[model samples]
Target: MIDWRQLREIITTPDNVPIIGLILAIAFYVWYGLRQARANDRLIREVEADPGRHRKTQPYEEGWEREVQVWPYLLRIEFLAALIVTLLLLVWSLCINAPLEDPANPGQTMNPAKAPWYFVGLQELLVYFDPWFAGVALPVLILIGLMLFPYLDASPLGSGYYTLRQRRVALGAFGAGFAIWIGAILVGTFIRGPGWVWFWPGQTWDHTRAVYETTRDLPDLIGLHNGVAKALAGFVAIVLFYAGAGRLIHWLVTRSETDRRIYRATSALQYYTFQFFAITILAGVPAKIALRLLLRVKYVLVTPWFNI
Candidate 1:
């Protein structure tokens, strides 16, 4: 059932090797961070129960000052880290060949022509979204959303520390967006084959393979054939989706007393901004992905200027 040869070729490609390394690094760091967070959370609970006890989340000796000089204490460690990274880069450069191809030819194009690995996620989004939406609007929204995070989040807990229980709503929203981006990259790298068709990891990359699947827009499914009717239908559907998803996310975020307090402290502007980005990016993305993949529905919202 598995084609080892095909899988080997994909994994060994020079352009793909970095993605493999990225996956490993992400896994290790997430595990380590969560482990540390658990330990710190336990320490926090103990200190809350017994205020007389003196404890530090980090290791501290009795004689050391609360802070140290940055020149030697911090810069030295940074310099050493830089040197180690340089050495590793040198070794890696020597071991692997650069992924370069011959000069481009106007007559022939490479099958499954892909963007650089970093932009592969956006490229994969083309399957489910229009070019303008995938390439421009989504990226702009993501940048703005990131910039708005600090202002939007009113929580003071878990500052400068890795603790999930204290910052569940903030962490959950960010983690969901990050996971979606990473998933898109992985799918683009390993699962997309010639013609941008979906292929299982072990399946052969057939150059001549032709898929003839028909996709439909949501409006078409409900017998809305006229252009204006389709547009109106799509607009109504999107409005309803936002209303439902916003309510659900609000309930989830305000389940705990801490969360409810934070929510109450936030200004209307901040709350609305957070809800807009959360529903659009965090919830809208997976919803669209599901529609496209499972229901074969495209362009849930179609207007004269844009189709989403």
Candidate 2:
């Protein structure tokens, strides 16, 4: 059972109050998305019914010309929204000071010291990854993946319009990734209390509670943690995961591919290469958590410099 009083107290904290507004904003965005999706679906059905009429009215290539000018239509809307946001921020600042702590003392470490709100997700990631990977490599890889997304996704179904059915795969993947980041931020902000221990809604906030348990590496889970064999096994696990999943997804999604072997090979290579990295980034945390809970596996990949 949850303690409503405790939950309310936690949410009323300065660090957590903004999340209420964020939630409401997300709800509005979802409602808007649904309305837009229904409209796009109806338009698509109408176009499919009378292809010649729709093409003559709105050509596929010159679809950009069908849009209105941004000067007033979109720009004014955005400008007014920004002005309202700025005023809200002004009021908020005047009423409440930003959450800040006193000057750091090297001698006394702050218990459960946290990063900035945006970075709290990365701080939470430290539980599953080394700092080098969580704080540095993961963020770098995410940026690189986002930059490479255009090249990876060659589909033109949702080129100039918003349609859920046309771009479900891409949007679903993005939404899932965004949700993971947001969940991490929430956990770091409210669920994590003193000493970086996870505190549930009903739990008492015990500052003196110790949470210092030695985590075990995956190799150690199977009675092997040292030597080249361990690294080989780790690499083999990752390769098998990608190879099996990639082949399966390719078969499912590309059943209508051309019979040209060379073209198919090239396309499959490109698609699976991108999928390998993206899936790794998306599934890394959940995989670690599952392993930790089920098999007590700590690090899935261990090297001299880093363990992930």
Candidate 3:
């Protein structure tokens, strides 16, 4: 449906949208770094100036320790979320009845056959580079970067206190990344406009399925494809995993040891294991999704070692 005349005529709309977004991003990061510098700059002292007397650290107070034990409050909120999710899942399972396709036909594949929701981002990435790059190498690199954040930017500002602005910025960005990942699924399902086709499993599989079946033309912008979306997703993940979320995780897990190297190594090892499990599960997405739907099985069964 794309012709030179029609394409040329469609260029009246503004094309600087992504550029504006990039400019805003650069400006915000610069501002954030400067603000951090200012906060730390105030704490700096001149070596030649009068030496200040440092106060001795006090022991933990009984009253303050009692106030910190809000486990009951945390547990109650967590249980409420779990109960709501379980009820919604029960309703969804009953209402949705998926029909089994005729025994995996090799010649005739289903249109828009996708992976499970958890692995959709990785599956989308697989479209960009080779399976090894998308499914393994990139995820490994991401994991390594996430684990190295503490050592890279060791600003012990909020180590013992919760009033640091850097912590707030990091937490906000981490929450935003989670929101973005969830938002991607919504956009993929609801906002993917017509006639756009990009996937080609083999060289022979012509990318005409969506083009032939759907209405409206695909986007011509730089980041309109699934591949670009995956890259954006990864970029956001890096922000959360390393810059934002990693800072919070470092504070949390290594808190008991005065935040030492041993604790950092322990947290990194835990992250490493989780990354491995996630990557493995993501690689088998196509089959995993098919089997789960067909057998009505959950990923985690009720075993003594684990509970779903």
Candidate 4:
């Protein structure tokens, strides 16, 4: 059998590097693309001037509307941003020292070390919900909701325009998610460390352990089957409030107590404010359960891995 690691080392050596091949491949593609563009331009002019050569020759010269696609410009920005982020990550990985924790023993954990950064938000969520809800259902629902976003709000109002042309609903969703949710994740991951602690970290408090203990007690919630029950109740309450509030506002607007247009504008804000809580409740479920695993909560629902 081939020694794969040895083979990889040989192929990756400085003398045998693939960079030379990449340069040549790029040069060849540039020439080939220019040639194709020139040929296409030549064909278009030939077809436009004569009636016999191409199939669709017209009696009168057809007027053409100039169209410019914004995608190419947007694509360049996206590509540049990706490259910059990748380079920053590489520098960070090299400069920052992260020593692996002491050898794993089944019953012990290292004092300050924890799971990777991306998972901290989800880990933090467990403080609010059940493990099944926090770990599985909530995360999955959030992802599914994000994926269905375009389909759910398929308005063509701004298709030929930019953000300024879109409805307030899209704008409100963007601000809530980008400004609030994403900023919290960034602060949580970078600013907070050790024990799901919040607000000013120093040698003064055991925020890490504090966060952990609080999350652990989350699952033993009084008179609770699962966090799903609490979330469902919250959902029902919010729906009733939103319906009542929206109708009252609309009726007031009809009487000219408020501007009808302004009331309509707030309609998106009202709809989205409720959606914000709905998603949070759904996400909090599994997080709570995962926290409770420490207390030995016997969640009767079986895992698929167990069945297998």
My TM-score estimates for the predictions, one after another, are 0.96, 0.81, 0.36, 0.44
Stretches off by above 4 angstroms in model 4 are 1-90, 97-99, 178-180, 183-187, 190-195, 202-308
Model 2 global lDDT (CA atoms, 0 to 1): 0.72
Which model scores highest in TM-score?
1
What value does the lDDT take at residue 155 in candidate 2?
66
Worst 10 residues of 2 by lDDT: 255-264
How many angstroms is residue 116 displaced in model 4 relative to the true structure, after the best TM-score fit? Answer: 2.2
**lDDT of each structure?**
0.91, 0.72, 0.42, 0.46
* Candidates sorted on TM-score, descending: 1, 2, 4, 3
For model 1, how does the per-residue alpha-carbon lDDT over 1-308 read when each residue is reduced to its tens digit?
78999999989999899999999999999999999889988888898999876678798778888888999999999999999999999999999999878888878887899998989999999998898978999999999999989999998888898887788889898999999999999999999999998899999998889888788889999988788999999999999999999999999999998799999989999999999999999899889999999989978877788788
What C-alpha lDDT, on a 0 to 100 scale, does residue 225 get in candidate 4?
A: 39
Sort every candidate by lDDT, greatest first: 1, 2, 4, 3
Clashes of each: 0, 0, 0, 17
- What is the lDDT for 29 in model 2? 93
Model 4 Cα shift for residue 110 (angstroms): 3.1
> Cα miss at 65, model 2 (Å)?
13
